[model samples]
Target: MSAIAIDQPTYEVGARKWLITITVITCAIMELIDTSIVNVATRQIAGNLGATVEETAWVITAYAISNIIIIPLTGFLGDIFGRKNYFTASVLLFTIASFMCGFSGSIWMLIAWRFVQGIGGGALLATAQTVLVETFPPDELNKANGIFGAGIVMGPTLGPVLGGYLTDNYSWHWIFYVNIPIGIAAAILSWKYIKGTKTEMKGKIDYWGILALVVGIGSLQMVLEEGERKDWFSSLFIVIFSILAIGGICLFILRELKAKNPVVDLRVLRFRNVAVGSALRFAFGLSIYCSIFLYPVFVQGFLGWNATRTGLLILPSAFLTGMLMGVNGALIKKGISPKALLIFGFAMVIAYEYITYMLATPAAGEWDFFWPQLVRGLGFGFIFVPAASLTLAGLKGKDIGQASGLSNMLQLLGGSVGLALINTYVARRIVAHRVDLMGNLSIYNPESNERLQMLTTQLIEQGNSSQQAQQMAMSIMERSLSTQSSIIAYGEGFMMIGVICAVILPLVFMARIKKGEALDVGSAH
Candidate 1:
C-alpha cells in the first residue's frame, strides 16, 4: 500500500469549514435522533393512529430496516453523484417525509413515510462523517470527531428524553414535525457550504449487489424488529424471513467479492485494524443500543415514571457524554493511546452496568439512576471516538468512505440484534423470576402470612367484604410479585451486558495497528 501524504487544509478557525461542520453535524444528529425518538412515543402514536401497540411499532421497525438497507450503499451513491448533491437530495427527502409522517392518517401510512425517511436519513449519517473528515485537516480530525462523537452518542441518549417531552407536552405528531425546521436549515447549509471530493470513476452500477443488499439487510432487520412480537420462529413470517435473510446475506458477500464496482467494497475487511474495529463496533452498538432501549422500559413500565420525568432524568447523561467526548478527543491528540482509552472505557461501562444491576429496584427513584447513567455517558464518549479513529487508521481516500459505511452497518445490525435478544431475555426472565418468587410463598412462611393478612385487612378497610378482601389481597400480592420479578430481570439483563463488554476487552491487544501510523479517524456523524 502506498502512503498518501496528509495535506493540511488552510482555513481560519471558526470560519467556513466550521460552519460546514456544524451544518453536516446537524444533519447527522437529526438522522440519529430520529432513529430512537419514536421509541418513547410509540404508545401515543398507536392510540392516535387507531392501531395496536404491536402494529404501531412498525414506525420504528420500518425505519430501522430501511436504514440498514441504505447505509452500505451510501458510500457508493456518494461517489457516483457528488456527495453534496446526494446529501442535499437526502435532506430534502427526509424533510418532505417528516412532513408526511406528521400528517399521516393511518399507522400504515406513517410506517411507509418513515421507511422513506429512513432511506434519506441513512445517507446523512455516512455522508456527514465523510464530509466532516474531508473538511478538516489531518491534525484537527480528532477535534472534528469529538464534535461528531457528541452527536452520535448524545442522539440516542437524548432520544427518549426528547420524545417523551414532545409526546407529553404537545402531541406525538410533533416528534416527526419537529425535524422540519432543522432539516430545512441543514439543507440550506449543505447546498451553500458542503463540497464533494472529486472522484473519477468509469464503471457500471452494481445492480446485482444492490438487490442482494436490500434482500439481505431488509430481511435481517425484519427478523430483528419483529422477532419478539411474533414469538420468533413460531410464526411462519419469521421463519421464512429468517431463511431469506441468511440466504440473501450469503449471496451478497459472494456478489460483492466478485463485482467490479460493488455497492459495499467487501475487500476493505482485509485490513486487520478495520476488521477488528468492525467487530468491536458491533459489540459497542449492541451494548449501547440495548442499554438505551432497556432503561426507558424499566423506568416507565416498572417504576411508573411519567414520560416527561423519565426524559428529564436522562438529559444530564447526554450533556456529560458530549463533554467527555471533547475531553477524550483532546487526550488522544495529546498522545494517549486508543487502546488505553478503550480499556478504561470498557471498565467504566462495566462499572456503570454493575451499579445499575445492584441498585435497580421496583421502587427506585430517578436520583438512584442519575450518577450511574452519567458514568455510562462518560464511558461511552471515551469508547466511541477512539474506536472509530482506530478502525479506519490505515485507509485512504475512497477507502475511508467504504470503511465508514461498513463500520456503521455493523453497528446498526448489532443494535438490532442486541435489542431483539434483550427483549426476548426480559420476557423469559420475568416469567422465571415470577415462578421462583411464587415458590417461596408457602402458607407456613410467617412473613408471607403476615403480608397476606396485612393486605387483606387493608382491602377490608377499603369497603370490601371478607371473601372479596381476601381475593383482592391475593391479586395485589400477585401484582407485587410480578413487579419485583421484572425489576430483578432488568437488573440481571444489565449485568449480562456488563459481562459481555468485559469479555471483549481481550481483543484490544490483537488489533494490528502500529503506534505511529496515521489513523483514519472520521466523525461518528
Candidate 2:
C-alpha cells in the first residue's frame, strides 16, 4: 500500500500512487496483449481443437464482442458493487477464464470462456483508466495519462510478438496459461492499492436501460464481427441482429431520458468536450487499428515474412512511441497547447500512412519499414494522452467515470468498425485490381507474349515437355499477377486510413481544454 499520511498535501503523490499505477497498468497491459496474442496462433488453435479456420475466428470475435458490451457498463457496475471490490473480482474472473480457455475441450467451450475473459478484461481497461485518472491531481493529469498511454500502445504490438514466441517454442495453451501469474499479481495489487469511495446506491436499478443496452450493443457487435462472414444483410442472423440493434438503441434512449437514474448516462455526452472527444477518439481508433491490422497481413501474407519476423519488425516502432510519451507529458505540463500537440500528431499520422502507401512494393525489404514505424510510434505518443485528458477536462465525480467508460467503449467500437471496413475494402479491391491487371495480358501485348514465351522456354530447358511447360508457365504468371494485385489492394487500405486521420484534423480546434488543466475530478472516493 501507499504511504500517504493525513498531513500530506495531496494523495496524488506518494509511494502508494506508483503502486496503484503499476497495478492498473499491468492489468490493462495483460488485457490488451491478450487481444492480439491469439491472432497469430489461430491456425494452431483450429487444428488442436478439430475445428475449421472460420470456427476458430469466432474465438476472436466472441472476446471482442464481450469487450465492447462490457466496457461501458463498468462504471455503473463499479458504483453498485464498490470500485475496489469490483475491480479485484474482475481480475479474478479474468484469471479464471484464462485458465478455462487453456483447458477447453472444444471450439464452443473456448469461445464461451473467451467471452467470459473479455468481460473481465473490458472492465479492467476502463476502470484502470478511471483509477489512474483519480490518482493524479488536475494539474498533473496529462503525465498520468501519458503513463497509461504507453501501456495501451505496447499491448497490441507485444501481443503478436509474445504469442508468436510462445506458440512457436511451446504450444498454443501457453499463451493463455501465461496470464496466471500476471493476473494474480494484478488482483492483489488492485485490492490493496486501489482506493475509492463506496457508492451509496441511492436509487433503484435502471433495469430497462440495462436490458436495452445489452440487446443494442450486443446485437450491433454481432453484426460488425460476423458481417463479412455472413455477407452483411444477406444473412438471416445479420438481419435479425441489425433490427434488434436499431430497436434496442431507440428504447434505450427513451428509457434513459425518463428514468430518475440511468445505467449508462447518455446525458454526460451533453458536455461539449466529451462530445468532441468521442469523435476524435473514433477517428484515432480507425486510423490506428486499421494500420496495425493491415501491416501484419500485408507483410506476412505478401512479403513472405514469418510471423516471428513480422512481430519483431513492429517492436522498435512501438518502443519509440512508448519512450516519447514522457517527452510529450513534460511538454504538456509546461503549458504548451495540447491542440498544438494534436495538430502535430495528426500530421505525423498522415506522414506515416502516406509513406506506407508509397513504400508498397514487391521488392521492399524489412529495413524499409524502420523509419516510418518510428514516426508512427511518435505520432501516437502525441495523440492518445491529450485526446483522453481533454475529453474529461471539465467534468467531475461520476461524470468522469461515465465519460471514461463511454470513451473507452467508443475507441474499441471504432476498432471493430475500422476492421470491418478494411476487410470489405480489401476483399473488393483485390478483385478489382486483379481484373485491371489481367486486362493487359492479351495476345497482342508484345511484352506479355515475350514474358510467357521466356518462362516456357526456361521450363523446357529444365527438362519439362513443351506442352506441360507452357501450362506451368501460364499458372505461374497467374499467381504473380494475383500477388501484385493484392499488394495494390493493401496500399489502398493505408491511403484510406490516412484520409480518416486527415478528416479528424479539424476537430483538434474544437477542444475546449488545454494542457496541465485536464483532470479536475476531485477525490472520486
Candidate 3:
C-alpha cells in the first residue's frame, strides 16, 4: 500500500550473484529433504521412543501442518522483517530445531521440535524462490528458475535415499543431525550474500487474516494428512477438522478481500495467467507427489524390495532430471513457450504412470521399472521450471514474492490432497479386490480345488501331517490372495493418476504469456 523502508541493501552481481543462487537453492533442498526424509525413519523412531507407529506419525503430521500454515505468509513476513534478515533467521530457526529434534528424549518432544523446524522450512522454500527472482536479471530469469527447479525436484527425490542410508547405517537422529551443518552454512551464506532490501509494503499487520489462515489452512492440511489413516469422514476427528477447514477458509477469504493489507493477496489470482498457472501448479503437484508416493509403496510393500533398494531405483531418474533442467532452460531461452513444454511433460508423465501401472505385479523387478522412471524424470525436467516460471510470469516486483508464495502453497496442498485420495482409494480397492478374489475359492471351483490340492501335497512333502498340510496350504493361499489384491488395487491407483494427468493437460493452453516477451514483464497490466 505504501513504500517505507528502513534500509536499502544493494543487489549482487558477478560471482556473488551466483553464490547467492547456490545459497538459497541449498536452503530449498535442505527444507524439502526434511519433508520426506523422516518418512523412512518413522519405524525406527517409534521403536526407540516406545510409541506406536501411528503415534509416531505426529512427527510428520506436525511438520506438514506447520509448513502449510507458514508458507503463504512468507511474502508478508519477508516484507516486514526484510528478506535477507528473515531468511537468515529462518535458517537459524531450522538449525536450532534440528538440534533439539536430534536430542529429543520423548516422542512428543521430537514432534514439537519437528513442528518448529517446519515453520523454518516452510519459510525457506517460499522465500528462496522470491530471492532467486530478485537475484537474477530479467533476461536470465529462466536460468535462475532452472537452477531452482532442479533443487525443487532434487530435494524430495533425494530425501528417501538419504534417509534410508542414514537410518540403515547410523541412526534416525543423524537425519536431523545431518541438517545442522547444511543449515548453518546456508544461514551464513544468505546473510552474507543476499540483499536485505525490504519490499515497498507498509500497512497494518493483518493479524485477523493470519489467524484465519492458520485455522483454515492448518485444519485443511490436518484433514488431508490424517484423513485416510483415521478412516476419513467416519472419524469424529476428521469431521470436526473438515468443518473448521471449510469455515475458516471462507472466513479467511472474506477477511482478505476486505482487509486493506491482506497477509496473502488473493487479488493476484485475478491476473489470468497467474490464476491459470496456479491451477496448473496444483495439478502438477498432485501428479508428481502421487507418483513418488505410490511407487515406493508398490515396490517395497509388494515387490519385496528394501527401502535402500527401492530408493536406488529412483537415482538414475533423478540424475536425468538434473541434466534436463539445463536443457529445458536453454529451450525456454530460445523462445519456447512453457505451455508447449507442459503439454510434453503431461504426456511423458501419463506414459510413465501407465507403464508403471502395467508393471505393478508380483513379478516386477528393478529392470522392469527402469525405463518408466526415466520417463518420469523427463516429465519433471520439462514441467518444474515452466510450471513455476509461468505461475509468476504476469506479476512484477513485490507481487512476484506474493505470487510465488501462494503458488508454492497450492503445489504443496495438491500433493497433500493427492496422497490422501490415493491412500483412501487404494485401501478401498484392496478390500473390493480381496472380496472378489475370495469368491473364486469356493469348494465347487475345480481350479481352486486343484491348486489347493497341489499346495497341500507340497506342504506334505515338506514334512507336515495331512491336516497340518491342508491348513498350511489354505494359509498360503490366503496370503497369496491378499498380495494379489493389493497389487491390483495399486495398479488401479496408478491408472487413476495417469487419467488425472490427461484431464489437466488441456489447462496449459489457458496460460496467456506473450511470445518472446521477458518473463518478469507484468502482462496483467
Candidate 4:
C-alpha cells in the first residue's frame, strides 16, 4: 500500500506537471482507443478463434460490462490507495491484460482478459480527467479541459482507423501489441512525475455496496449488450437477467443512500446542477454512442465499404470535433453562459441527426457523410466542455471526483442503453418496412412487373432456362426490396435519436447554479 497525505498546494505548470499530464492523457487515449479499435477486427478474431460471430461479440461486451461497473468506483479506489500508486498499477494491469488478450487462443479466454483490461482501462479514463483538472489552476482549467476533451474525441475516432489498418495489413493481434510501447512510456513518466494527495477515512469496506453495484451494473450491461441479439425479453436468459438487473440496481441505490460511507455518494444529487448535468450527460452519451454505432454499420452493411475505407471516412469529422472543442472551451472561459452553449449544442446535434436521416440511403457515399459528420463534430464540441464545466462548477474537492464518476457512469450506461434501443428499433423497423413494401407486390403493379421482367430477360440472356431465369429475377427483386427496407429502417432510427435529443432541451432551464461557484463535495473517500 502507498502512503497518503493531505491535498498539497497547487502545482506550477513546470516540466513535472507537463510530463505527468502527457502520461495520464496517453493512458486515457489507450483506454478509449480499445473501446472501438477491436470493432473492425471482430470478424478476424471470430474466424481465428473458431467462434461464431455472435459468440465472439462477447469480446466487446465483456470489456464494456467491466468498464461500466468499474468506472463509478474509480474515485473510491484512487482514494483507498494513493492516486499515483493506483494509476500506475492500473496502467501495468491494463498493459499486461492487453498482452494476454492478444495471445488468447480461445474466445472465452480472450473475453476474460478483455474484462480484466476493462478493470484497468476504466480507472485510466476518469482518473486522467481528474488529474488534469487538478494540475491546472481554476483560471486555466478550461484550457486544460479542452486538451483532455480532444483526447476523448480523438480516441474513438482513431480507433477504427488504426485497427482497420493494422488488421488489414498485418494481424489483428497487433492492435493489442501496439499498446505495449505506449504503456511502457506512460508508466515510466507516471512513476517520475505523478504525485499523490491522500485523504483520511475510518470504516469497513462497503463490500455490500460494491457487490450490489457490480451485480447491478454488470447485469444491466449484459442485457444492453445482448438484448437486441437475443430478441429482448423473448429470450429466457435476457428476461431473467433483466429482472436481476432492475432489482439489483434499485437495491444498490437504497443501500448507497443509507450507507454512511457509500461507495458512490448518491447524495450529490441534491445539487440541482449536478443532477441536471448528469441527465444531460446521459443524453449526450446516448447520442454520441448511437451515432458512432450507426455510422460504421450503415457504411459497411449497406454500402459494401471495406473497414479501412469506413474508418478513414470518419477521421476528418473527428478532427473537426477536436478543433471545435478547443473553440468552445475558449468561449466558456470568456464568461459565456454554459446553458447557451449547451442549448446550441443540442440544436446542432438534432440538425446533424436530421441531416443523417435525410442522407441515409443505399446510394449514399463517403462524400455524402462528410458534411453531416463535420456538423456532428461541431455539435459534440459544443456539448462536452460546457456541460462538464457547468455540472461541476459549484462542486469542490471530493464532490468534483464524485460528480465526475457519476457523470461518466451515466454516460456509459446511456451509451449501452441507446445502442440497444436503436438496434432493437432498427430490427423492428426492417420487418415492418419489409411487410409494407411487400404488400404492394403484384403482377399488375406495372413498375414491379417491368423490373422483374427486365431482370428475367437478363438472366435468360446469361444462359439460364426461362423458368430458372424467372425465379432468379424474383429472388433478386426480393433482395433489392429488403435492402431498401433496411435503409429506410436505419433512417428512421436516426430520426428517433434526433427527437430524443430535442426532448432533452427543456431540462437546461432547470439548472439554477451560476458559473464560478465552487462545489463543496470533497474527493472520493
Runs of candidate 3 exceeding 4 Å displacement = 1-11, 199-201, 521-525
Worst 10 residues of 1 by lDDT: 1-10
Which residue pairs clash within candidate 2?
A: 2-16, 197-525
What would the per-residue lDDT of candidate 2 be over residues 1-525, giving only the tens digit for each residue? 011112222455788889989999989989998889999999999999999988999999999988988998887887767678989999999999999999998999999999999999998988888787778876667777788888888888888889889999999999999999999999988888786445555678788888898899888888988999988989999999999999998998898877878888888889888988888788777777787899999998988888789888888888887777777878877877778888888799889999998998988898888789888887887888777766877787667777878888998888888999988888889999999999767669999889999999999999999999999999999999999999999998998888888988898888787444545566442
lDDT of 2: 0.84
Off by over 4 Å in 4: 1-5, 515-525
Candidate structures ordered by lDDT, highest first: 3, 4, 2, 1
Per-residue C-alpha lDDT of model 4 across residues 1-525, encoded as one tens digit per residue: 111337654654788778877899899889989998998899999999999999888999989999999998888888888788889999999999999999999999999999999999999988898887777777666766777777877787788889989999999999999999888888878877787766665676788888999989999999999998888889999999988899889989999989888888888888898998999989988998888888888888899998778877788888887787778778877778889999998998999999999999888888899888888888888888877877888777677778888998897788889999999999999999999999656698999999889999999999999999999999998998899999999999899899999998899988875655543433332
The CA lDDT at 517 in model 1 is 66
Q: Candidate 1, residues 74-189: lDDT per residue as tens digits? A: 87777667678999999999999999999999999999999999999999987887787777777777777788878888788777778888888999999999999999998998
- Candidate 1 collision pairs: 393-519, 393-520
Could you report the Cα RMSD, in angstroms, for every candidate shown? Answer: 2.9, 3.3, 2.0, 2.0
Could you tell which candidate, 1 or 4, scores higher by TM-score? 4
Consecutive 10-residue window with the lowest summed lDDT within model 3: 516-525
C-alpha lDDT of all candidate models, in order: 0.84, 0.84, 0.86, 0.85
> 237 in model 1: Cα distance from truth in Å?
0.6
